[model samples]
Structure formats: C-alpha cells, structure tokens
Target: MSLLENILYFQGGLGVLANMFLIIFYTCIILDHRYKPMDLIFCQLTFIHIMMFLTAGEIWLADIFESLNVKNDFKCKATFYIYRVMRGLSICITCLLSVFQAVTISPSTALLAKYKHKLKQHIIKASLYIWSFNLSFSSNLIFYVGGFTNVSETNQMKVFKSCSLFPINYIIRGFLLTVTTSRDVFLVGVMLTTSTYMVIVLFRHQRQCKHLHSISQLRTSPEKRATQTILMLVVFFVAIYWVDFIISCMSFLLWMYNPVILTVQKFVMNIYPTITPLVQISSDNRIINVLKILWSKRHQIFKKRWFFCLL
Candidate 1:
C-alpha cells in the first residue's frame, strides 16, 4: 500500500478500536445503578458522540475503496446526511449537557435555581427541541449532496473533496452552524464559569466544615462529586472542540490540504468523540461502582443459566 493508504488504514483501525472502547464503556455505564436519573443524560450525550464517531469512521474506512472506485448517489447523499446530522446533534447535546450541569450547580441567588424543577421536568422536551432544530435546519443538505459521478454525469455536482459531492451547502449549513456555535459559546461559557465557582465554593465549604465543630454547622453529608466530573466533561468538550473548530475554520484561511494534513485532521475528527464516555466512566466513582455491580449481576446470571443448561 502507498503512504496515504497506510495513513488511512492506521487511522481507520485506531478509530474502530476507540469506538469499541466506547461501546464497552457505555454498556458499563448503563449497568451501573448508583447514578441517578440525570446521569442518563450523560449516557445520551455519549450516544450522540458515538454516532459522530461512527459517521466519521465510515468516511475514513470507505475512502480507501472510493479512491479506486467510487460511490453511488444514494450512498453519497445518505452518508453525507447522516454524518452531518450526527455531528450537529453531538455538538448540540454537549451544549445541553453543559447547560444542565450549570443549572444543577447554580447558586441560590441565581434565577434558574428557583426553577430547578423545570430542568428536571423538561429534559425530554429540551432534547426533542434540539433534534427538531437540527433536522429542520439541515433539510437543505438533502437536495445538495450526491455522488461525484452523478454530479459529473448531470453536470451539476459541486466537489467537496472526500466521501461525496456536496454543493457549498454553505448558506444553510452556515445558518445552522451560527445558531449552534452561538449556543455552544454561551452554554460552555456558563458551564465553565459557574462550575468553577461551584468548585471553589465546595472547597471553601469543605474548609468551613473542617474548621468548625458544631453539628448544626456541618455541611451536607459528603459532597456531590458529579459537579466536578461534569465540569471536567465541559472543559474537555470546550477545549477539544474549540481546537477542532479553529483547525477546521483555518482550512478556509489557509486553503491548503495535503493528504498528510487531511489525514491527521480526519484522525482528530474521528477520535475525539469516542473519548468522552471513557472520561466519564473513569472520573465518576458512582458510575464506576454502578457498572461493576451491573457487570457482577450479569456474570452471575450468565453462570446460573449455564449451570441450568448443563444440568
């Protein structure tokens, strides 16, 4: 195989491996029961991230074949659509998760604290709104994407370089990106700012509890560590994603794409989405404990079933 081929293969294999880890991590998270209801939101967020991983993974792997051969119009359009939708939703959900965490840690003086129940009650509604928003905004892309061959045959296809032919699709995509980017900046900013304050308050509260010796002055029994983990998640999401956005946007200003650079960029695109669930599982003691219990139960049940069948 050629150098470019080797790069592609390596990246594809690595992405698949990362995705496998994502699956194992997700299964463990689901099995763990100590995590409360909102913890499932973290799982749902990871689901979207996994979708992003799968979409990008397909493009990376399929590019090998497409290099020698080509793709069909339907396949091109479908892959393009799914990739865009999944990526869009993944970012949207990350923003939602950050907002949810921020609200959870909101100070008493904060207005949202008064409406805390609404956050709990309206999570489903909020998620639906996010999906509906993306679907509606991404509608135009359906008309604009097709196979390169089809575009060449019809003399109407615009080249987008990799997996499929896509027109600029810029106006609609830009509009959607604008909305999402604004929300991303705002929500991530809120999450980081608020989460930072919450951490400081928690530490100070810890010190206060340690210094004073009255039962009445005691802080809430043990602190909730979820806020800290969620903060780490937000920080990771923002720092990594912002770097991606900056690199992606720089492509326009630089207007240069060597196969090596593109391959590296593609690797970054594929790998980052799969890393979040592992981070959550590693960082959250509750999630880890719950997963262990779930796994033990599953193993015992499997053993019992095996014994019965053998008998």
Candidate 2:
C-alpha cells in the first residue's frame, strides 16, 4: 500500500481502539452503578462511534485493497444509510447530552431546572425517539445509494471515490438534501446553545464565589468540569463537522476527484470519538479516584510482596 493508505489504516486502528476503550469504560460505569439513563445514553453514543468507525473503516479498507470485490447494491446502500443514521444519531445524542447537563446544573428556580427531576425519567423514551427519527430520516439514503462498479485500470472503485446521492431530478434531490442538512443544522444549534448556557452557569457560579477564595485556593467544581468537557466535545464536533461539510461541498462541486478530502474527512470525524473518553476520564472525579485507589492498592501489595521476598 502507498504511504497515505498506510497512514489511514494506522489512524483507523487507533480510532477502533479508542472506541473499544470508550465501550469498556462506560460498560464498567454502568456495571458499577445502577444503569442510569445518562449512562445508557452515553453507552449508545459510544456504540454509535464504534459502528461509525467500522462503517467508514470498511470503505477505507476497500480503498486500500482494490482487490476485494464490492458488495451488492443493497449492502452498499444499507451501509451508507446506516452510517448516515449513526452520524445523525451522534449529533442528536450530543445535543441531548448537552441539554441534560445544562438542565442538571441549572439554578433551582430556572425553567430548565423544573425538568431536572423529570428528564432522567424520560431519557430512555427520548433516546428511543431520537433513534427512530434518525433511522427514518436516513432511510432515504438507501434508495439513492448504488453499488460500486466500473472499476478502472488502477483498480479504484467508484463507491470508494464517492457514493451516488439521490439519483432523482435536481429538485427532488435538493429537497432531500435540504431536509438532512437542516436537521443537522438544528441539532448543532441546540448543542452549541446548551453548551454555552452551561459555560455561563459555571461562570456565574464562579463569580459569585470569587470573593470568598483566593486565586490559588479556587478549585474546579464538578459542574464546571463537566461543562468544560461538554463544551469541548461540542466544539470539537462542530469544528470537525463543518470542516467535513466544507470539504464535501468542495468535493461535490469539484466532481469528488480528491482522495485527500475523503481521507481528511474520515480523520476529522474520528477525532471526537477517539478523544472524548479520555476527556471524560479527565473531567470525571469518580473515574480518576477509582484508578488512583486501584493503583495505590496494587503498589502496597507489591511493596509487601517485595519485603517478604527480601526476608
């Protein structure tokens, strides 16, 4: 394989490993505590990350090994459809997560705070609704997507280059595209707005307590830490998505000839999923405390064993 292809594989491998870690981390969290609604939703998000990486990774591998035969039209369409749905779901869940956190940290008398007690009760229902909506929305992609055929002398597949979109007339295609784009735009707006609200809440809380503490004495509140984590996730997600959006628009206008755009887009999408769990571990005190406790216990055991052996 070429250097670029080799790099893609390496990145893809790292992304898979990251997703695996996210899965394991969240699964342990749920196992330790009674499976909370947020935990379940987070687990769903991680699962989507795994599937998203797998779907994209498959296309990447297909590009790498030109020798592998392309699947039938159904598989091609289904794969892309599933990928799109998972992607949409990711956005929805992120937005949901932001809103959940925002609600959790809202002032007692605030309108959002009213739902604080009720949100968790409906999280499962809300999540199911999100899945259903995205699934229905993305079902259109299957009809538009076609199989990869007409391989060139260089053994490059058309699907690897660019999968066909809405084979209908321009007007119909435009309408479908607009619907999907608007959906994304709306969800992103929700994520940004909620995240910003969270940051503001943290700022206000910090400001109110500013007089009581010196600069060195100030510590990060769990709410503030969680807000920062969510904000980072949202910022990373929006940046990657908008970059992908621009690249996709450019590629479409340019006849999608650029392999580099696709590679970069895949890489950008992987960044959030790969880094999110690490960020979570950093922001979450419980996880860090557990790790520290385990490490200290192991060290003590090792010290005892060493002393016994020396004696």
Candidate 3:
C-alpha cells in the first residue's frame, strides 16, 4: 500500500479503538447510574463516529461486502449512504452537545435556564428525531451513487475507489444541494451562537471566582471542565468540517476528483473523531480513576504470579 493509504488505515484503527473505549466507559457510567447528561451525548457521538469509520474508512466495507458476494452497486450505495448519514449525525450531535452544555452552565436567571430541565427530559427524543431526519435527508445519495467502472465517463463523478456519483437532473440536484446547505448552515450557526454564549458565561464565572477566592485556592468544577472540553471540540470540529465541506463542494461542482485531494479530505474528516476520545479520556476524572483502578488490579495480579513462580 502507498504511504497515504497506510496512514489512512492507521488513523481509522486508532479512531475506532478510541471510540470503542469511550463507549465502554460511558456504558459503565450509565449502568452505575452515575452518568451525567452529557455522558449520553458523548456515548451517542462515539457510536456515530465508529459507524462513520466503518463505512468510510477505505476498504472496510468493500472487503466485507465483497466477501459476502454482494453486488458492487449495492455495496457502493449502502456504504455511501450510511457514511453520509453518520456524517450528518456527527454535526447534528456536536451541535446538540454544545447547546446542551451551554444550557447546563447558564446562570439560574438566564433564559436558557428554564429549558435545561426540559432538555434533559427530551434528550432521547431529540436524538431519535435527528436520526430520522438525517436518514431521510441523505436518501438522495442512494439514487445518485453507484459502483465505479474502470471506463472513464464524463457523467460520472468518482468519489470513492469503487463508488461514483451518477449524474442526476440538474434541477433535482440543485434542490437537494440547497436543502443540505441550509441544514448545515443552521446547525453551524447554532453551534457558533452557543459557543459564544459559553465564552461569555465562562468569563463572568471566572471573574466571580476571582472575587470569591484566590487563584491558588480555586479549582475547576466538573461543569467548567466539561464546558471547556466541548468548546475545544466545537472549534476543532468546525475548522475540520469546513475544510472537508469545501473540498467536497469543489469536487462535486467541477466533477474533478483528484486522488491527492480525496486522500487529504479523508484525512481531514477523520481528525475530529480520532482526537475526540483522547481529549475526553484526558479531561474526565471519572475515566482516569477507572483506568487507575484497572491498572492497580492488573499490577496485583502480576505480583501474585511472579511470587508463585519464584516459590
């Protein structure tokens, strides 16, 4: 495999592993009934990222479907469709996460405070709606994508190694593009607005803390840490997401899918998913404590084995 291909595989592997770890961690917290509201959001996001990697990570679905004797066209359609759905969910859930965190941190007298209780009660319902919307919104992809034949055709736009987008009626394409763009713009606008509100809230909270306590005496609350983490993720996601969006738009518009450009886009798309779990693992005290406990148990087991061997 080429260096680019090798790098892609490594990235996919790392992201999948990290996401799996996070899912398990959140699952444990939920089972113990010690989970915060954001834990549910984090778990859902991790699951979506895992699905995205499985569908879009080069060769993952291709190899599986090929082994199953699936038709190439069907494989292409299913793979692209699922990838798009998961991609849509990623943005939607990320936006939800930011909004939820902003609400969580809002002052008691703030307008968002009244909705905080309602948000927690309706989180599951909101997630279901997001899934339903994205699943339907991306239905157009199934009609437009097909297995790419080796023969060059002016009408086909190759998006993956095995999948190309079939030309559709210009009017239909324009309508779909408009709707997709609007949905993305609206979600991104919400994310930005929430993020800005969070910054203002954090600033005021910090000033209040300074007045109440010395710098050395102050410690970060769990809410503050979580908010800061979400803020970091939102900023990073927005940056990476736009790069992928621009590349995808240009490729679709010009019907020019350069191999290098495709590879770079894939790399950019995977960045947020890959780093997200690592950030959560480092920042969350609960996950850290769990790791420490597991490590201590393993160490004790090793010591007992070594003593038995010596005896």
lDDT of each: 0.62, 0.73, 0.88
Clashes of each: 2, 0, 0
Clashing pairs in 1: 32-290, 32-291
Off by over 4 Å in 2: 35-37, 59-71, 151-168, 214-218, 253-255, 290-311
Tell me which residue pairs clash in candidate 3: none
Error of 2 at 256 (Å): 2.6
Give RMSD (Å) of candidate 1 vs. truth.
Answer: 6.0
Q: After superposition, how far is residue 5 of candidate 3 from its true place, in Å?
A: 1.8
TM-score for each candidate, following the candidate numbering:
0.69, 0.82, 0.92
Residue-level lDDT for 125 in candidate 1: 83
**How do the candidates rank by TM-score, highest first?**
3, 2, 1
Strongest candidate by lDDT: 3
Q: What TM-score does candidate 1 get on C-alpha atoms?
A: 0.69
Give the lDDT of residue 111 in candidate 3: 92
User: 16 in model 2: Cα distance from truth in Å?
Assistant: 1.9
